[model samples]
Target: MADEVQHLTRAFSGLGGLGVDEPAMVSALARWRGQPEKRSGFRKGFPGFFSSHGEMERCEEEYMLRLAAEFARLKNLVVLWAMHPWERDARLAHHVLHQHHPAAIVVEVACTRSADELLGARRAYQALYHHSLEEDVAYRARDKPYCNLLVGLVSAYRYEGPRVNEEAARAEAEALGAAVKSAAGGKLLAENGDVVRILSTRSKPHLVETLRRYKEIHGRRLEEDLSGRGREETTTLLLEAVLCLTAPAKYFSQVMEVALREGADEHEKDALTRVAVTRSEHDMDEIRAAYEEQFGAKLEDAIAARAHGHYRDALLSLVMGAHHHHQ
Candidate 1:
């Protein structure tokens, strides 16, 4: 059943031969360079933003989809110029291309739902251009902390193409759990780190079963193992993200409430909205409470100030805070 819709779905910095002066794009970069800059709020998980469950409907209309379209068109252009792979300098140049073409980068990231397609577009760009896409990314991402994030996105720890129940996830999780419980506790092999490298697939059923089986075998839970590792925050995030890998709804209450209470502005509200739109498909009641505790305010009240109509109503419906369970 998961096979039906293959979900859809970063960079470095360097300078030189970026071709920032390429045609109409040169003018666009100049304008953006001229505008006042804004920070990436929340890093961007505003505190008290998610709850146990999440809002699910995409409210397709609500998303600025057209922006993504523009990015797609521009990314293709960058790829065209990248035919000759260069070193770090050229990679930074690629992002300069993105910064040069803000719309393209925004659009590409927003519309990109999967790492596979993202990598595909990247490879296509590399194949056409002489340089590897990674170089272009690194070059453009220079100095910005988000650079690592852009690069981190290069590969997926999860599987792609199909949600085949090869039990691949089960085996991997069990192996990881076993390793963690034995002599390998808190020890990651040189090879394992990226989600693309670890569990190997983002497919749902397979992952759930994997975690579940891991618990049965190891006595300790997957979350427990994850939280026990070094880099406490990263560990929590890793576990949470994995849980979200299959059940994004579970964290909605925490994400939304954080946004609304701490949001204090449209940007914050928009951030919460962004989180909710994606998670709405999951349970939301748990999310609401988490929000309340995290932000000391109800998620509904926060959104009430700015939202209206179907998109607003749909989210409210979820946050009505009922613990709706799936049959």
Candidate 2:
């Protein structure tokens, strides 16, 4: 897979965009010295070695520790990147979570941003300790977006989407292709928001058209490339969602399928929650309609009897919410 995915690139970049950059807030959130003498606030999250800041750093643990303060302090993320390095740094992830701290901000940032950077940091972190970073990340994430981001990014690679066309489609297609082509094959674009932002700011229609043309020339099918490789029904559902390009019906399929499988485990439940919460912000009515026809029931009816907990609540609310073209 690595060799076949040569010149791969990240389709989405959560780090590149700065809807709001607040550094003061980030600094405020940093409890660097808030812990007892030996235990800094960032301790406890580390294992294999000393869980102290001095221990991790003395061990040269390469990672970033972000503070909620970063988002609050400034509008831009580049500042937060300062604590995080252009290179992989897991010390950042380890310390912040401090033993019982929900999680250090480094891991959270890794969850949402570049997996290559995260993996690099994780590897660096592990090499110092002689273990797998992947295992550590899993145990720490519990069941939430942090887990989703980390797992998704690690698995992310060069994924070709179905063809698209727009006025700027040509420019956007090339730009997107170039970004991926230039990257090491290890990165993932889990956050498609950045990708869309870059492409759609131009002319969306042209972008779609450009996708169609690029695929013709390179034999790259974004839809198949993104989700088609995996055999699981969920993977197929993701492929369809990416393929939807317009309706986002794949989100619906994923939600319904979760109920059909393993009775919707906690992990599956969060994804369902997000779809319900996120889709309305992105024109989910089409998904709602698709749900009725494809699944043989309104999405609400489908989950009403089978799902439970806050996760189930979030999904139903999202399905019921008014469709607002973009979240």
Candidate 3:
């Protein structure tokens, strides 16, 4: 482990020179991709190793800037992939809070992650920015329904056990249906505490059963009911949260489809890199299968047609699990 750390330090040191050794960096990163202990060791040892020169921050900034100038997407991908997962998610949450339609990213992080992972992200957010994620989200989304929904999500710490109450789930499903119905009929969704409470507090298995009961009772999916009305931001956000919690693979595959479409703007296209990098080890195979089933084309083929050069190579490496190799 000590020798591996030293090797990684030396390999990363090359980034401060005139040009980046792309192959060397890729090889080192790939070797450590799935080795969580080694990556944790690298993070702990990096600052200590570089602090002697007092150039750690400068080197990182310069390297990132150079990469941004040449390959903006690659810069984002590399920075996110190299960080500890908690810090990576914290940074992503901070960034997307300032962008348009921040609901998707916020909901993704809140709903898709395990309870401990979400808590870790919140701790990292506080450590990095000196503010809690819930507080920041509340401040940014000052409106009634948006603030309520976003805050509830970030502050949640649901139970992770397999036990679920079918009776309570059925009742909660009715409550949720009533809330949506009231919201549609001119009530403020923020006033519907049942909606936020059930969503933010219920265990995943409980929620899944509730959603199934919702369809059984209401004769339609909750998402379908939400979309049958107009495309209000709050309604859309609610739909996204439900989909993320219930069917993450489908939600992610839909995001990738949008990112890979013709003439996609920078924000839209960035979703590809985000989803690929974050889900690579956890569930990339599920996402890839979902993508092919939904879009009727291979994800790798779509990426090859759209992305170019080393950016393409890095993304493919991640998506295909090539990064797990020692090289």
Candidate 4:
């Protein structure tokens, strides 16, 4: 048993030479300490090392399990440390929103967070990437169909209050309905600015009221009105944005469903990673509930089916562990 403990200690000591970046490696070492210390913590329960053959085998098994856990922690920390958190999120947002050729993902993230959180993410982007989030959005958005609209949506600093203006909601509901009706036949004009202004400027409470009024006045949900209108891609994208902003949990649940579906492509799996990492610390419970309700399976089962290797293990740690202590 003594020989086994010494061998394991040497093995762990040798891992220090992996020589990754300082912060990530340091974090991994810290977690290693936290998890491995439990081995030492439980030592009093057992007789001293070299007690018996059976005891030595039990000790070896316990050490191996703890080491596996520590390795998992180190692997996850390395991925998290690869970039600044905001930069990572910015890249994911860019991939989901821009590279994918639509802006609903950007709108979902921007609109879902409180104003301060959105501003903080932008600041992190500027600090790490040396450009504002809006700057990147503006540069990419220029000359696109919904360029101004996308730019406006990302740039918005909507009021984070609960206040709802009944009159404004009613008026804007009519404006939105009229804008949708005018957008038929894929004919877009600068007048789509009305839709942009209403979506980007309104508070969540106010927007919900406007959408409810839109349904009452137009005899259809705003999204239903927008859909099947023979509109262009930008108009359809804008509809997705409105739906996500209106019900973020439902939107993300749908995202997860596609990402976790059998034979899901790499992009879909990447979307799952982004959603898992970003929402793990926030509303994963709500997202998971939404997933189960929508797909009739636990999110964990879906992840286990699609993900493989350390990627699978790390994501499961985030999704299943519910311990969001990422540094």
C-alpha RMSD by candidate, in order: 18.4, 19.9, 12.4, 12.2
- Candidate 3 scores a C-alpha RMSD against the true structure in Å of 12.4
Which has the higher lDDT value, candidate number 1 or candidate number 3? 3
**Model 4 worst lDDT run, 10 consecutive residues:** 13-22
Candidate 1 structure quality by residue, lDDT tens digits, 162-261: 5555566567766676555552543442224434345333455566777777777778777666666665433443455555554444445544544445
lDDT of 2 at 78: 28
CA-lDDT, candidates in order: 0.44, 0.43, 0.78, 0.66
Candidate that scores best on TM-score: 3
Q: What's the CA error at residue 180 for candidate 4, in Å?
A: 0.9
TM-score of each: 0.41, 0.34, 0.76, 0.68
lDDT of 1: 0.44
lDDT winner between candidates 1 and 4 = 4
| Model 1 regions lying over 4 Å from their true place | 1-154, 157-167, 182-196, 200-202, 230-233, 260-270, 277-327
Model 1: how far residue 82 lies from native, Å: 31
For candidate 4, give the lDDT of residue 149: 76
Model 2 root mean square deviation, Cα atoms: 19.9
lDDT of 4 by residue, 1-327 (tens): 455444444445322221112333444455556575445533434443213454342445654554454355445444654655566566656665456534656776677777776777777767766777887887876777777777777778888788899999999999887777676645573338788788877888898889999999999998776676556767566776786678777778888888766655545544666676777767788888888998889887776655544555567776766543333
Best candidate, lDDT-wise?
3
Model 1 residue 310 CA deviation (Å) reads 14
